[model samples]
Target: MEVLEAIWGLLAVALLAFGLYCCYVKYVHLKYDYIPGAPRASFFFGHLPYFWRKLKNKEVAHDLFIQWAEEHGPILRINYLHKISVVILSPEGVKEYLMLPQYPKDPDIYSMFFNIFGVRFFGNGLISDPNHERWRKQRRIMDPAFSRTYLSGLMGIFNEKAEELMKVLEEKADGETEVDVMSLLRRVTLDIIAKVAFGLELNTLHDYQTPFPRAVDLIAEGMTKIRIPFFQYIPWNRKKVKEIQDSLRLLRRTGEECFERRRKAMLNDEETPLDILTQILKSEAQEGGCDYDSMLDNFVTFFFAGHETTANLLSFTIMELGRQPEIVAKLQAEVDEFVGVRRDINYEDLGSLQYLSQVLKESLRLYPPAPGTVRWTGTENVIEGVKIPANTALNFNTYVMGRMERFFKDPLIFNPDRFGKDQPKPYYCYFPFALGPRSCIGQIFAQMEAKVIMAKLLQRFEFQLVPPQRFKVLESGTLRPFDPVVCRLNLRNPLGF
Candidate 1:
């Protein structure tokens, strides 16, 4: 009887505290009432339900943001519970915020990313770290890995993996069979990152039974659940939660084994292959070393970050090229002229494919793999004459800003010509790899890898988009083609080889 009474008393106190916190949240949120935004459907849930509904229906969240941008002007405030996040969809705002390091990534948003299903995902990794100084330290240590000399050495591996993919497609390029280009691209990119970054032979391209690829896919798919409040407690999500946890365990386990092997090699004074993992280990040793878990954090980071964005870009570019044959012909001509019948693509050949470069830039303008980045405003700020509250979530997206009519003429049209040599460069408006000090360290590396794979594909094949397939975007870790970029391929000018 006494224990029961005590439990009841504690429950009463907890309920009362929760009620007060809710009241405080509501009061604080009202402070941003002046910011222009869509009418709230409910004070408690805000737009989260709407966002979730869109995701549930296999739709992109950025489309809704674009709609609100059109309706409520470029700057809008969206609320979830008591939190108010500001969305900036203008070039001026993007320049003011993204072009400077004054803004750091939103801790609240990044905190959500630090764990998936209670397992640490990108904990303190370069992408999920909110601390500016710490992130800078990591970035400085990892810079040498992405240098031109290091990446140039990776050309052989890039060509080898791409050739494996081409051979796979060659088997299916009989024109009667439909191939899911995006899946094959994902496998090839996954294979490249594994081999180049960690010196692991993932063999995802050739091996259909790899558990790592399926685990990664599950992890990406399961990441969306992070947005739901107290998702783990929900009965329906128990199976999903367990699956995500299992996937995370597999990745972390593999990461630990890889780290141990590298450490053992260094300890034995063995010949360590110069790769990203070696660079990280060298940095760790020189810097008096970080914990093993810290190394694991980066190992997982490099695997996901180094692979998905490049694959998405390549796949999206392929889909667009299929839709526009004339543009494809132009790209093919550039590749043919520069690359000729060479099966081996060198770093020098990457620069001369100017038309292909424009096509890539144009594709990124439309479908930025990561969509956008969010910044946490710790103090009140002003942008474009509008007052912004402190402690607000600020979202700036290339996808939104790149599509605005004010920034790009005929924004809806996919025109690679807009990126012609004579055309003015998009300074602030175009940030596919983001901008400022927090910009992606692997930008050059990703683009170079993309160019190699794309050059080879264009040189070898003529692909037609399979009809009845929706070319929409999937909001996974990166935005991928919703229908997997299904295509029917035929060898183009077989004698050219």
Candidate 2:
């Protein structure tokens, strides 16, 4: 009771003193030198309470970001508990701040990735890691996998998946009923990705009930693990991370098994049938570059990045088409003129459809898969007009950038004419695949996938909105439309196809 009480009293006094000091620093000193951003801290927790990260509505997210931008003058700070990050809003600011050598492209959200995948797999990937030289080398290694002419060679895979999707829709609407276009698009995207990335051709669209498809489904569930943020510090929530890690390991093991089988088949036959994965293997073999682990890393990266964006973009496009009948009708006519009621749309005919391209560009502007991109200052650099010292984290919300009034004439309105031939070039203003030296390599693949799926869907059936047009946001690590987007797909040559 003697020494223990004295120690306890001293500890309490020290804690109280420290807490008071923290309050003074946050509320007083931080206001002057810490850079302006969020409101002054209300003592202990700082400004943590202001972060609306749980927000599911993207419009709300957009509005809040705009508010921050206005107040903080483009670059601003917000505390994620003890970690403080600066958010940059303008595209100009991105070029100025994010592109500078001083600001390294820190995959800041990488901490959120947890154990579902490790830094070795996800972090080492082209999108996540930002070392400019390392990325250049990795991009070169992965280049052949998505060569302009080479990817179009896999058009057959998309055609096959598209036809299968049509067949499933036919069965569901045997006598003309409603079906969820979003779910159907997800399945089709998965199947196409399955064939191109792994060369497995699981046909997840036709049979999602089976084991392989179930595993794929589980992978999607694991992706949703991105939302659980507090799991990092609270050991209790680490179980979710462990569960995701297990799922990732399971999928990776599946990829390895597929890689081995594919290699074996190639060894036995020498010239059976080779696609992107085969090409990647051959490319790696010849150059003696990129070890097994690196290739495997890219295998997972492309496999995941390849499908989800295409699926979500198509889903949103279909939803928008349903809302805008005139646009849908026009798009149908374009599909009809190029493709037909009697045949599938081939690669040769894909380019002739100009309107098809416009619709995709417009939809991408509205709901870009990547909500924001982050970079850290590797050395002292200036951005947009602000002088940023080295090691400062600069995060730009590209999703918000796409909808900025400064960048576009009317930010909220959806118009494909924004991308028409005569329209002024929208260069830095619109970048769904990002921009500059670090722009996405798989953009060509993504565009082709979207076109094929949409062309096929428009040919077979017409989409009509089942919802009352009230928007709901799906915030994956990327953003998507939540709630099974129900649409009426009336089978016809609605595009006169």
Candidate 3:
């Protein structure tokens, strides 16, 4: 113990000396790109404490980013977790930086996830693979599956899952029952992703001992395990890596069945398309669409980015509804009024839920599924009059952007009215969907799914937050509700909506 303490003491001294040297170099020799308000150097510890404190409370990170922005102006440099990560605050800067191909997805983001998943990208869709050309090609084919018209067809899948969710709630809500709404959302989402994306009927909502459903959870949890610096580098992380791979291998086995099932269905030229698997199979049927190996990668990406993100958003939105009764009532009214006219909402109906859409917009503003988008500059560039040195990492945190006072008056308030026709936030100020060349291709698909799921939920039961239950958001790969958003689902008098 004495020797260990001695080592730690020595390490601390080394860190302190290194920090001081960086300050001296920046202050005396190098005129650092000074953003006015960034944390000035401390001899013992640079910007480390502030970064650590900010990340401890996930909600605070964006606010700190805003604070740094306010102090240093727009483009500012701050060292975080021993790395010099720059926070670019302005929308113009985001556009400029994200537009340039010189900035690519950081190796760390993929590496951490790859370590967790126990697999490498075999040329996937837009998200996982490094090859831009292959990604672009696959994106074009996969794009149609998430198009406006395509989402309309998929509404039934969401509605079905929502209905299944309600059934689970009803089954469990007998007496003083506390429901893990987030868990159910995960199940429904898993089922929906399986049915829609893989053409497999997981029915995780119904089944407990399913390989695919368990695999999904393992992947999510395993992915989180890899985020730690210890897991990223240490020898013990190898065991964790194997567990993650086992989870992914199970998923891949499921995906293989999906691949073969869809191919057979396609060969028969059946009149009915199964789901996203059908779309992928159809795309692959054409020459130069997606090769077999790449299709598997897309299957994985679709499961994670499409199913997982939407599920987390649904969970977050539901929790928000439980907390904010007023928003829930207003959204429920819109659902009732819309259903009164349309009977069953069609594609046009999905487009017309303006208030419901706005409410979701507000929810996402607070709890973005993907909190911070990061890019590493492959070349030197300037953002908001500040020159970013090549090889410097750029982090544009959506969680932070949504909270800046300059972006929205009373930034923390939950007000959907901000997005109303009378008051549209400037494009840069609001990019929950992101912007530029590599913007989310599935934005429309996500929005449509959110509106349908939330609208459906609000229609039947009034979801109330269980007293003081609240989530401290965590930006683990994607933004996630910490765990256990307990809620009370009380069924109201039968109302047609």
| TM-scores for the candidates | 0.93, 0.87, 0.85
Candidate achieving the largest lDDT? 1
Alpha-carbon RMSD, candidate 2 = 3.6
Q: Residue 341 of candidate 2: its Cα lDDT? A: 76
Taking the tens digit of each residue's C-alpha lDDT, what string does model 1 give over 1-497?
A: 99999999999999999999889778966788788888877777787777778888988878887788778888898888777888988777787777777789989888876878889888888888888888777777787887888888878888888899989998998898999998888889999999888889999988857789888877887776776679889999899889888988888899999888988999999998777888878877776667566567777777877888998999899887878989998989999899988999988999899998999999999988978899877777787678988777899888888888878999878999889999998878888998888888788889988999999998999899998767688886578888778899899977766
What C-alpha lDDT do the candidate models reach, one value each? 0.85, 0.69, 0.69
Lowest-lDDT window of 10 residues in candidate 2? 112-121
Each candidate: RMSD to true structure? 2.5, 3.6, 5.2
Candidate 3: residue 275 Cα off by (Å): 1.7
Best by TM-score: 1
Error of 3 at 202 (Å): 0.7
Worst 10 residues of 3 by lDDT: 28-37
